[model samples]
Target: METAEKPNHIGRKIGRIRELRGMKQETLAEELGISQQAISKIEQSEKIEEEKLEKIAKVLGVTKEGIENFSDEAIFNIIGNTVTNHDNSSLLCFQPNFNPIEKLVQVYEENKKLYERLLKVEQEKIAYLEKLMKEK
Candidate 1:
């Protein structure tokens, strides 16, 4: 007699992948056009319908097989190995070819532009309120 293998918790895998991607149940529900409660129920389930699973996989930007084989421990192990070899020397080095002062100036300019835009928006709101008061 052939023995049947136990199935994995596919729903839990999907939920984990969704969480790793920084997606909320509400966001997944909105993308799937379902309710948040429905999403909660799905995540709590051990199995999901194939069509629904496909939809969820697409939204989470992963293949069904990827979710099935996802392991946090494996990811951390890979990162640890990459960071520390047998000798414990660093595998990666940081060398920036660009000038730090130039980058800082660029960031400062971007922030200034954003602040100016916000100030303009506040000024517009004030002008609108003043106009409304004059009308009254």
Candidate 2:
């Protein structure tokens, strides 16, 4: 009996790397000047164009080859090997302490605040312009 090998999906690799880097799709989309939906579509793709892949790699802070060669097992192995107790036993404390969703929400709140501030300034400018025009 022969088992078929699964294809290495470049898009999946890109998504994993981005997640590992603690990045959100919105952030990645903003960096690439693309829509969040576009980023979602790209992640769903099994294959991506080489030039576009290069640009994505740049935004992810990884080389294209690195994305192509990415493996979850390798990351776990590296983390497992690097961490150890004083007695020389390996400690498996691999879970991320911070929540990714929380980070994304914080960013969203910051952007909303900035947008509100800018809108207020624009409204004040318009009011000033209206007052000046009334005097004319």
Candidate 3:
């Protein structure tokens, strides 16, 4: 006699994805415009409404189908197989073919431009406020 396997729980799968993505229940609740307790309840439920599930999936940076089909074991197996050394040890090290200092300088330049734009906006706001004060 064969026994039937239990069906996967959609809520549990969604909870796992949210955990893996480093999101707190409160954060998800804020994004969904619901309470943290509601998020906790949703995580404990076996099934969720399709519309709510789609919203959660979008906030978690995954599709509804992706959430439904996700498996932690499959992810672990893929990473384990992909990073095995000749001795079957799993000490994976990545070396990028670019200068680290150059990348840092590029990022710094971009931040500087943004800061300049923000400063300009603040100055404009201050000028407008001063103009209003003079008129009054």
Candidate 4:
């Protein structure tokens, strides 16, 4: 019989916990004294040595066992507990479900529309000023 493929628990759990703590990969990398590229590799489920795993667990404030064994359900429970302990202030601030790049595009489109409208308003103001000057 073929052996079942092991789940990518380390990457998935790390990603879940990091997002729950509102930490970026670069920030975590800096805290652990590792390069962001290394963090990226970890998040992407690349093989990590035992020493690196220990460092990551220390930086994330999780136990080495927790890093090694967390399932998706366990990670979700941890995230839920974290949210419950905090004030509801971030209820509105949390855009955890949205993709960052998509949000950026949305803001850009909104600003572009606002800029076009403002340009039209400015042109009208200039026209009114010219008419007033000619009348004077």
The lDDT leader among the candidates is: 2
Which ten-residue region of model 4 has the weakest summed lDDT? 82-91
Q: What pairs collide in candidate 2?
A: none
List model 3 lDDT by residue over 1-136, tens digit each.
9999767788889889999999999999999999999999999888999999999999999999998888888889999898756763433555679998999999999999999999999999999999999999
Q: Give the TM-score of candidate 3.
A: 0.61
The positional error of residue 81 in candidate 3, measured at the CA in angstroms, is: 2.0
The CA lDDT of each predicted structure is 0.87, 0.92, 0.91, 0.83
- Candidate 2 vs. true structure, TM-score: 0.61
Compare candidates 1 and 3 on lDDT and give the better one.
3
Model 2 agreement with the true structure over 51-88: per-residue lDDT tens digits: 99999999999899998889998999999898765663
Task: List model 1 lDDT by residue over 55-121, tens digit each.
Answer: 8889999887787787777878988887745663443555689998999999999999999999999
Deviation of model 2 at 80, angstroms: 1.6
Q: Determine the C-alpha RMSD for candidate 1 after optimal superposition of all C-alphas.
A: 10.4
Clash pairs, model 3 backbone:
none
Clashes of each: 0, 0, 0, 0
Error of 1 at 112 (Å): 14
